[model samples]
Each structure stands twice: as C-alpha cells, then as structure tokens.
Target: MKKIIAFLILTQSIISCSNSDDSADDNQISGGKYYAVGSTYGKNKDNNFTQLASVWIDGVPTILSNTASSSVANAVTFYNNDTYIVGTESLNNGNAILKIWKNNTGESLTDGNHTVEATDLTVNEGNVYISGNEFIGTLNSSIATIWKNGQAIRLSDKTSEANAIYVYNNDVYATGYKIIDDKKTAIVWKNGVETVLTSEQDDLESIATDIYVDANAIYVTGYLRNSFKSKAILWKNNSPATLSDENDFSQANALFVHNTDVYVVGCHIDTHQYDFVGKIWKNGTLVKEINGANPKSIIIKNNKIYTAGSGLDEKGMNDEGKIWESNLNNLDFIAKYKFPNNKVNAVLVK
Candidate 1:
C-alpha cells in the first residue's frame, strides 16, 4: 500500500519567525526574526557524503553536527532563547543514531546498536519530547517510541511509529501508524493509551502525521492510502474527514486549529510524477495549492499562515529552502524567502 510519510528534519535549511505585528490586520503578514530547521548536504574532502544538521537564525545557518557520513537536522523548537533540534546521524560503523542539539552543542541519545528515527520534537516545561521509532528485539520491526528527557517510552505493541507529539495540560498525545490486523492503521496514543483513529477497513493503510489539541477538541491530520490512491485525512474528536481527493496521491503533513477553523498543509505529487504540489485545506476543503515543491510543516498565527521547507524557484530549476508568509483569509502569498539548499525538512515559529 502507498504511504504518505511527512517527517521534518533537515535535507537543507532552517526557519524561525517571531511574533508578527499586532496591528497588521487579520489578513496581513508581518514578522520579526524567524527560525527554522533542516539539513544541508555536500561531499567531504575525501569525497564521502556529508550532511550537516543545522538551524537558521535570521536566515543564517548554524551547523549543529557535521559528519562525513551523514547527519540531518529535522525538527526545531525555540525555548527560553535557546535552539533545540533533533535528527539522525549515520555512523561509519553503519549504525544510525539520534542526535539532539541545543544551541549548537549536541547530545547523542542512543548506543548506535539499532536504527533510530528522530522525526519530530517539542520542548515543553523544560523537558524534551521526541517522537519516532527504533528497530530492535531481533526481528527488527519498527517500534513506536517517545523520548522524554532522554528516557524512552514504548507506545505500540507491534510494528509501528509515531510522527508527531503534542503536550497539553501535562498530558502527552502522539500519533503515527501501527500495523493492525496486517494493515497499517493510523493511531493516537494519549499518554501511552492506544486509540485507533482511522478505520481498519475500507483501506489498506493510513498514517497520522501531525496533531493539535485545544481546550475543546483534539485534531489530527495525515493521509489514508489504498492500492492506487492516497488521500489526506483529518481526525477531530475521533471523527475522521477526508481533506483531499480520493483519486490522487496526497498527504497532510501538519495542521493548526484556531477558533472554529482548522488549517492543514500537505503535498500531492502531480500526475506526471515529476513535480510536487503543496496544498492547504481549510475545514476539510481544499483552498490552495502551491507549486514547485513539497511543504512539510505549517503554523497559523496572527491570521497568517507560516509553512516552510524546500521548494524550487519560479523557473523550476534551483532548489532552495524557503519560508512563505501568506494571508490566512484569501491564502494569497505575502512574502517568500529563499535559502541556499535544496532540501529543507521543517519550519517552526517562535
């Protein structure tokens, strides 16, 4: 079955945005210093591959960790004026490990025995919450996990993984996919209690990519997949709704909920299979489509929509990391930024 796995960690650049102007009108875009996360890649002097986990402050990259093998910076969060980023690094010995960096210095969280995925993260109440999976216990099946303050907690009983995590009222809510009855099913774990969000029937697979919680409801977004098509899905209060067409390849990467409306951002591959179209869905309806590249993360603040990752230029030639500011009402572009790399995995606002 097809899967729409949208995880943020760097393939290229970083992003950040301070609070926007309070008087710019609900539909206007305004911002201060912005921060983002992603990875930049190149060849080392030995012609070995190299990927640097990095964070961008004011659009300038600060390398987190450099390895001649490979390292990626995927998710970033700004807390107490410090930068926190998480990703993976492949060792020369062939073990992939998770790396978490704070203000450029780093911490290696694993023993490099099993493959680890550092998909997304959040800094809450002086503790770090990271969602991903690790392969262990002989069969090497992926096991869903959460690392809180560097301590591992299991969230699944079988082959599964978590894509996103959010903490509200001292409770942890995480989402991803689990192998249920031989089908990949979307799941939500509330403080480690299992709650299957997507149907176990009518489809071969599903993934829950991102989640948001407010005072009244829990909103989760991802995609549902079958043999031929992948459609975006939104789960609010355990009720599921399709956000994209059922006839195409589409996935919701992230979402933000405000008042009575929900904003979802994702990507769909074009029919030709060469180009990716970014998409925005509001309240289960498609409202905008961004051409040139895929977007991985989104935030709705001050009536402005902030989403960033890597995208090609207007000429469709140069690949660059970019953060776009758009009007939340009309979904019109207001500002755009281009960085030096080709694959940016994530964007976050301060």
Candidate 2:
C-alpha cells in the first residue's frame, strides 16, 4: 500500500503582553519556556505533500529535520538544558529512518533500509533511552525495541512494539503489545523480562500505550478491543481495570501520576466511532470530559493541568494540534492555543 501524505499550511500566532489585560492573560497561558513536539504539513521541494518534525516554543515552531524526507516528532524530553526528540523520517521506498534531535540538531539512528519509529524517550544521567519498533525486512515482522545511547535492544522475538518507556532506580520499564496467536496482548518488560498484562484472546485485541513505575506499583493505560466495543484500561501490577463507562467506548492515550493520584487522558467514542469527546480521569473516577478531541499527552506542572493533542478538523476527519490549560484543582478552563495543520504528539514544560 502506498502512503499519501496530507499537505496543509501551518501558522503560528505569537501571544505576548499587550496593553489589554486579556492579551496579557492569554500570553500567560504558556508563560514560561514551553515545548510541544509534533509535525507540521507543508509542500516540500518536490511540491509534494510532506511534513517536518518540529518543536514549538512559546507558540513559535522551529523545524528540526532535514528536507530530504518527510518527518515527525513523536516525543520530547529535556535534561540538563538539553532537549531530546524522537521520531522518524520517511524514505521514498516507504521505509523510515529513526531520527533523534538534540537541541534542534538531528541525526539518524538507522539507515532507513527498513521501517523504524520512536514513540517515546527519556534521558537518565545523560544516557538517552528511546522506545520504538524496527521492522525486519526479510521476515516482514516488527520487534519491540529500546535504544540506549543509540544501541538497539530487542524485547520480543515476534511481532511487537514498545510505545512508552520509564526508568526508575536504574531499572528499565516498557509497555506496548506483543502479538500472540494472531491477537494483540498488552505486555510490559522490566529489565528485558516479559510480563503479560492481558490474556490472549482470539477475538479480542489489547495494547498498553503508556507505563509508569514507582515504589508502590507499576501503572499502565491503554485499551482492550473487541468487535463492537473498546474500553479504556488501567493496569496496576498486571491487574486490569477498565476506566470507561458502559455507554461509550474509550481508549486511554497517556497518563500521569502526581502525589499518588493517577491522572489519565483519552478520548471516548461512540460504538460506531462517530462522536468523540476528550476525557480525564482521576484515581479511577471520571473527573472531566473535554471538547471533542483526542488528548495525546497530559502533565501537571506548578499546580496547572496541561494537555497537548489534536482536535477534529472541520470535516471531523483530520487532526489539528492544540494545547489546553486548566486548573488542576477543578479542571476549569485556563487557556488554549491551536497550531493550524499540525499534529502534536508530546509536550514538555520548563
């Protein structure tokens, strides 16, 4: 199958302090140095629809990838005044080269002979850890992989992908899915040992997209899918707990834990996948349901709740990246900013 990329102009609106109080308040939304990682669509040199990996700082975007191929930023992290971004740059052959950017400079981890992607990353003691998958061309199968300082570590022998990574006490933890008997079973790996988070069911599929580990327990969030319904799930110490209601199907995209309180963000869709509404859950209870959107990342900084993701376009078929700010206590609206024609994947506040 051939991939068709979308082309759209991405524009940024710089908000700054002005004479009006409303303008100053709006500028305070992203007051400090803020970062959002994603991709923006534009026409490349060939006049073809393509994208460039970018990091948005205070609503202004700085492109990170070369124009040789289309690229995207899937995750972002900062450590000791250095910024790290992980994603992929596509080749004409449809293969992707896993790309990493440090402080707006980019490099390739792979040669682009086969497909490779990085969804999340972390920096511990100046060592870069990235979670992703690399396709084995001859076998046509993908393996869940972790890269430590540019060295690849495989977590599975079969089809699998790791979407999130966390390092605690120098122990590496990752979560995603492994294919079992043609079904997807959510899994976690601690120091390369596989731990199953869901039972393999022939008629059902499951995935663990995010993982967090502490002294208390291992926390993960994703979804279990059957034919007609999907449920947002949180796994604590390998035990499954659904976070969705009976009336709607849902998928948890990412989660954050603060002061022993688990905070999750995702989207709820109807059975037919028509209507969509963003939602937040606190400690297994529904805290708020946002506008129609899909939140990809959520975090709490300085007692403020910040979410970065995409909302449906006018046609409700495409995604337009946005950042939402709200009060952490009551989930009340504080501010919002939209990036035209961009798809945000991660956010970082400094």
Candidate 3:
C-alpha cells in the first residue's frame, strides 16, 4: 500500500538571526562543505538502478560515471574537517560500492576496481570508516564487514548484515544483526571485536541505524521488534533503552551529540499504523515532528538545528526530499525547502 506523508511548516519560528552575516549563496553555494545527492544530469527510477548521488559545493555531484551508473546513495558523512566525504554507492546490478570523494573533485578512493555496498560512513582524525557487506562470489551470501581506508575487516561472516558505523577515539564501532542457528541476533563490534548485544527472539529484529560518540561514551539508536511491531531504542555502552510509548512502533535513524544534549531522527508508527510518523528525540524527550516524514540525518551548528530527510505525499507515495533549518537556538523552524533530489543524503553546517 502506498503511504501518505506530510511536511508541515512549524507555524512558530524558532530560528533567530545571528550577528555573523553569511550570505545564503555564499554560505550554501561557495566553498560549502556539506554532502548530498543531486539528480545526475540524465537518470531516473525507470533505469532500475537510478538513485541519488553525492555532490560538492562547486555545483558538481560526485559520481563514478562508469561502475555506479544506476546507483542510489544512502547516506554520507564528512570526515577530516570536511576535506573528505565517504558514502555508499550501488550499481544497476545491485552490487554495492563504497566510494570516497575528496573535496568536490569527484576523486575516488576505491583503488578504481572493486565491488562493495557501504551502508554508513564516518571518520576519526585522518581515517575513513564504512560499514556494510562484501559481496560473495555471485551469490546473496554477503559478509558483514567494516572498511578502514578501503582495508576490509570482517566483523561477522555468519550470513549477517552491518548497517551503521562510528569511530570513537580511533576505536571502530559497527552495529547490525546476524543469523545464528536460524535466529536473528543484534550485534555490535568494537575495534573488530564482536559482541552480541541482543538475543535472537522470534519476534525481535534489532538493527542499530546510527552511532554517536562523546568524550566518555557511545550512544546507538535503531529499532527492536517482536513479530508485530517495533520500538525506538538507544544503547549506551551497549545497554538498551526503550524510547517509544507503549504500542507505538518507532525507530531512530541518525544521531548527533552537541555537548550534553543528544538528538536522534527517524520515524514512529502509532498503534493505528499511522505509517511511520517522522520523529525526533532530544535528550530522551519527544520533541516535534518535522512532518509525517522520516529523517535521515541531523546536525546542530551554532545552536541551530538542521534536519534532512524525506516524506510522502497525501496519496501515500514518497514525495520529494526536504531540509529543515531551525531558528537561532533551535526554538522553531526557520525555513523549509524541497531539497534537490539528484541524490543528496546528508547535510553539514561547517
């Protein structure tokens, strides 16, 4: 069934004007360090492999052109102070490619030859990290692995999948799930060390979608489910916390930590199956719904909150993409735009 989603304008303006006068064009178009997927010059959904791609501030999108012809970009993370951006790419054949772009030049970091599917991207210091699966010889049996600078480190080879990655103090953390003895179990890896965080329950499917690192701890958020519905969850030092009201199916996809406040973005499905209402959780409290849309990424700069994700139209069909920027101090929404859909995934303030 098609789903109907809404992108609402928070009538209240919480964004404030700052003393620093950065022109919109200068701030967004010139020497910008954010990451996104814009529509390739000529591609669409009918191509069976067409999707969003990464672009630079200079008005050019990062693409391999040859191997990733019909690839859809999932998410992007800027590393090394935005000097480098890393994300996942897929080919029309369904094989995934982990690609790295330097600046906005479209330079690649994949040795120019290899098949991969990157689910998440992150970096610490000068190191780039990716978590996803490595394809197995023409089969569906891909192995869960995390790559550091293109070097593959398998976390779980047990017919598993890795969806997210984070680096804290140079220690790598990857989360996903594995099939053990015909049961699904949630898993997390620290520096390639495997640790099972949740058991294999029949009705439970635990998947960690994002990771947040602070000076002292790591916070992970995703969804855990039984046979019927799922619930939003957070893991501190690998411990779980339920964030949904009873009977509400929810998920937290992207995470950001600004000082002592922790923010997460995703969607929640009410008991009536309201079709995954877009949601944000700030420091353990349900703040506001940007729209009936799902949030893919979030950022806080200069005390302003910005969110990027997508929503569905009234016809219950996924609509155009979006970006929401909060007023000063993030007291309310300042501006909302139908973000370009060429293949953008994530946004960064600096």
Worst 10 residues of 3 by lDDT: 11-20
Taking the tens digit of each residue's C-alpha lDDT, what string does model 1 give over 144-205? 89999888998976999888887777788888888888987889999999898855345558
TM-score to native of every candidate shown: 0.86, 0.87, 0.77
The candidate maximizing TM-score is 2
Taking every candidate in turn, the Cα RMSD to the unseen true structure, in Å, is 5.4, 7.8, 7.8
Q: Under the 3 Å rule for N, CA and C atoms, how many clashes does model 1 have?
A: 18
Which numbered prediction scores highest in lDDT against the true structure?
2
Error of 3 at 5 (Å): 18
Tens-digit lDDT track of model 3 for 52-129: 454534334555343455544454444334544454455555445666655644544454234656666665556667
| Rank list by TM-score | 2, 1, 3
Candidate with the larger TM-score of 1 and 3: 1
Model 2 CA deviation exceeding 4 Å by range: 1-31, 199-203, 271-273, 313-318
Candidate 2 local lDDT, residue 148: 94
**Model 3 TM-score?**
0.77
Residue range 49-105, candidate 2, lDDT tens digits: 778888899788887874656888888776666777888888878899998899888
